[model samples]
Target: MASIKTFINDDFLLENKYAQELYHTYAKDQPIIDYHNHLPPNEISDDRVFGNMTKVWINGDHYKWRAMRTLGIKEKFITGDGSDKEKFMHWAKTVPYTMRNPLYHWTHLELARYFDIYDLLNENSAEKIYAETADKLGSQAYSCQNLLRKANVEVVCTTEDPTDSLEHHQAIAKKDLDFKVSTAFRPDKAIFISHDGYNDYIDALAKASGQEINTYGELCEALENRIAYFDKNGCKLCDHGLDKMYFESYTESEILAIFAKKRSGKELTGEETSKFQSAILLFLSETYHNYGWVQQFHLGALRNNNARMHRLLGPDTGWDSIGDFPQAEKLSAFLNTLDSKDKLVKTIIYNLNPADNEVMASMIGNFNDGSIKGKVQFGSGWWFLDQKDGMTKQMNALSNMGLISCFIGMLTDSRSFLSFPRHEYFRRVLCNLFGAEIQNGQLPNDMEWVGKIIQDISYHNAKEYFNF
Candidate 1:
């Protein structure tokens, strides 16, 4: 008789013996360095215990919310006042329908890894899984901090706005825990002059930095003050989310005039807006170089497509998609500007549009002056492209265009603590790719050397890159 294989078996994503050995030997047991994510710092600081599966899994997960909405589940059960179990049951019903979507694999992976409930989630199994998970979640062993420990996380770097207090990160630093927590400075609001409530956000930033900003110079000073504060508090990186890189030319006087106009609640022309954005982005990058911080740009997201839903539910509620922007010209100009000035810090650029995979991969090579290993990197696939196909294409592009051995591997980039399994998912995919190549005689049969490379991509490279 043949043995039965579970939906998420030991060899779930591994297709052959080489893949299994590589994963189990080199990829598994590697500590995670989640260098970029959106997890709430307060929960980790407080060590809060999320008492049920829905609270920990379904709530605030726009990924699940989007899927539920597509399956015609009502908003009440998805994101509104419905009971926790009700939302989960609705999600469970949508799981089978999520087949061929990354959600199907992610859902089961999370379930099996976190809750130890290996049975596939459906309407019939929902009740049992929910009850079992709720019981486990209600324990002290499942607190926010413990959840991270379960995932073997070594360092988790969360993203924060310029105005954030970072008191939670400060608090976490004092703890004697096994893992470390860091933050990334995200000043997108400060650079986006055309966004709604931009002035209001400026006011908040002023308060946080303890400086008044009536002029463009004052604005730069305020941001610089905050960067200093973040650096003092152990922030090692910064992140930006943009439709595309901004590289329009402008004079200081022009930028100052644009700032004055926007601050006075006066509308500016498209040219003025682009010029202001370009100037501020340049200023921030220069400041980041001075502080010796890594800079990351996540480009090509077409956010908030559903205006009506956005008005009702707010941003990041899963109304975003990939954007088709002319990335190369502006991106090349922007990086070249920094490189020419000799002020380019270690940089990673992530793209959401699959069409720009090779474009971004090749673009990073121009400015990689070899002062450091993988100095300017085409970052891993992000947002909509975090799936298996997306990750594969990104690695292939980088391998063909640049060096994959020095690639800083996966990050959760997720809001949920349970999402750490994504690192494992990425590792499995990476091992299978190399393992298949070895099997086809595309490369020499050197398991030791290949395994070492796999380990670097899995864990060591990021450890060296970030110095964490």
Candidate 2:
């Protein structure tokens, strides 16, 4: 019998020789532009020294939490009061069951890439790998900033709310680190008018902007104030996570009345909520355009599905799923609304459902207008769709409908420090797609041009698109 090969070798996912060449020669060395993620800027600023694998890998990682829960592991070892070692052990036992899932690939890839440990994670090897990582993580070389450096990350943008002070970002700027850290303004809280704590959040926004919110007009003013502040602080982009685009028509008086009723703790009718969300979202988008900032909309998430678990663990604890919202008409109308006023800035639209890949792919071309090279983008597969099959479908859709050559490629959009290997995963997948097409004679065997295109998708495109 033949012996089993190494699980995560250099050409792990590169299938053909051309695929291997493209990845190694072009895609491997490109510095990553993790332009969107939920990594806490405070950790980077403080250069946090995480003490163990549990701290760096498992802590607050809903990806792992979801896996552990699916494997019949109890909440204690997953997210509750279990000891860190216990949690790491539980994770190791669960790793073998994750085969064929992206989590499995991500798990071993992170171990190999970050720790230089090529051993597959499982029950047999868990304790040894766990101890090895614990020792390295406890050392100074594994500090948060140093870990980012080890990944060869050139620029990374962490998301922040409108009310954020960005003190950590400021501190990082003060230090001149090798990598650049930036902020993207996320105003989801402000747009979510009918959410549970809208009024209280508005009050916080009021304090953040030094303006009292008494009317719909005043609310817009406060948001604009925050936008100006964010722009002054070197913000080049903004992000929105929504079920779908809202384009409901509303008069100024109607929006004002709705804001007043909500502020007074009155319940808003569904129509009233839609109108308010539409108005605020449009206002924010226009302001982003005026400031020449790229805007990203992560659409189609049905959040907080399991009410009991959600209430127990709070948001982003993995109770969310892809929402099959009707996207095209409203999304088109929303972008057209801004385009009619010539206020549509550089835009990226990410769809969570793979079924809408074609819709999103075609939607971007409607507004490309040749003013910029791929100005509006059908973004890479996101959220539930960030895996191999989903990414392949997204690239095929974009290549068929638009210019994949101009594509600004992968982002972590993750909360864990160990998630940077996701970029490598994306690059390998990207190269294999191009290489297969070359082998099939769909295009000439022009390795030079193909290599350039692959490299651009890996790094240069995002850098030029975001101008980071």
The top-ranked prediction according to lDDT is: 1
Q: Please, what are the lDDT tens digits per residue for candidate 2 over residues 19-93?
A: 999999999999999999999999999999998999889988888888899989999998899999999999999
Model 1 has an lDDT value of: 0.93
**Per-residue lDDT of 318-386 in model 1, one digit per residue for the tens?**
999999999999999999999999999999999999999999999999988989998998998898888
The residue pairs in collision within model 2 are none
Candidate 1 contains a number of clashing pairs equal to 0
TM-score, one value per model: 0.99, 0.98
Q: How far is 245's C-alpha from truth in model 1 (Å)? A: 0.1
Clash numbers, per candidate? 0, 0
